[model samples]
Target: MNILFIEDDRMNRRVVRDMLDVAGATMTEAESAEEGLQLIDTQDFDMILVDLRMPGMDGITAIGHIRAREDEKAKLPIIVVTADAAVDLRDRCIEAGADDVIFKPVAMDALFDAMGRLLARDSDGMLY
Candidate 1:
């Protein structure tokens, strides 16, 4: 699967990249929300993992920009990979169009589980 990970921290990106490598998936890294958005415009991805905090734009706003797109790409699965522990973080992400939310210092299994769930569903929201 092709995945785009938008995170500012180089170490976090490295860790996730290693995890994706182990899963035999290809990952494209973006250091900021702006870069991630530009990547989205140019390439397609099976899934996106975004960090909540970034220099230019936050992950939630980025998801909103994606969901507002005038094409099928708007439906691309997105997972919020954040360190935020706010009481309403998950709710906020869902409201902003995230398919799932995974916490920072992510576990390999959790990442795979979330990806699997999203991949198993068709665009119509039915199991494939």
Candidate 2:
């Protein structure tokens, strides 16, 4: 599957990229929300992984833009990755249409499992 990853931290980006690569998925990386949005406009990806705490146009905003698109692109799966493990934060992301949320200091197994679940969800259109 082709995945777009939006992350600002260099180390975190690298870790996620490596994990995705090792998982055998092709990935495209974006260091900021603007870049991520631009990529969304220009390419096709099976899924998107976004970081919540970014300098500008955070993950929530990014998801909004994606969902605002026409029907075809709007159906893409979006997962929010954040260090904030607060209950309310996860709730907010879910309410805003995020498919899933992952905690920071990312665990390889956790990420893989979450990615698999998100990507392999049934055709019934359930986000998670």
Best by lDDT: 1
Worst 10 residues of 1 by lDDT: 119-128
Off by over 4 Å in 1: none
Off-target runs (Cα >4 Å) in candidate 2 are 126-128
Per-residue lDDT of 17-121 in model 2, one digit per residue for the tens? 898888798989999999999998899999999998899898898888888888677878888989987769988998887988889889999888888787677
Which TM-score value belongs to model 2? 0.92
Candidate 2, residue 86: Cα displacement in angstroms equals: 2.5
User: Local distance difference test, per candidate?
Assistant: 0.94, 0.87
Candidate 1 local lDDT, residue 54: 93
Residue clash pairs of candidate 2: none
lDDT of 2: 0.87
For each candidate in turn, the TM-score is 0.97, 0.92
lDDT, candidate 1, residue 4? 97
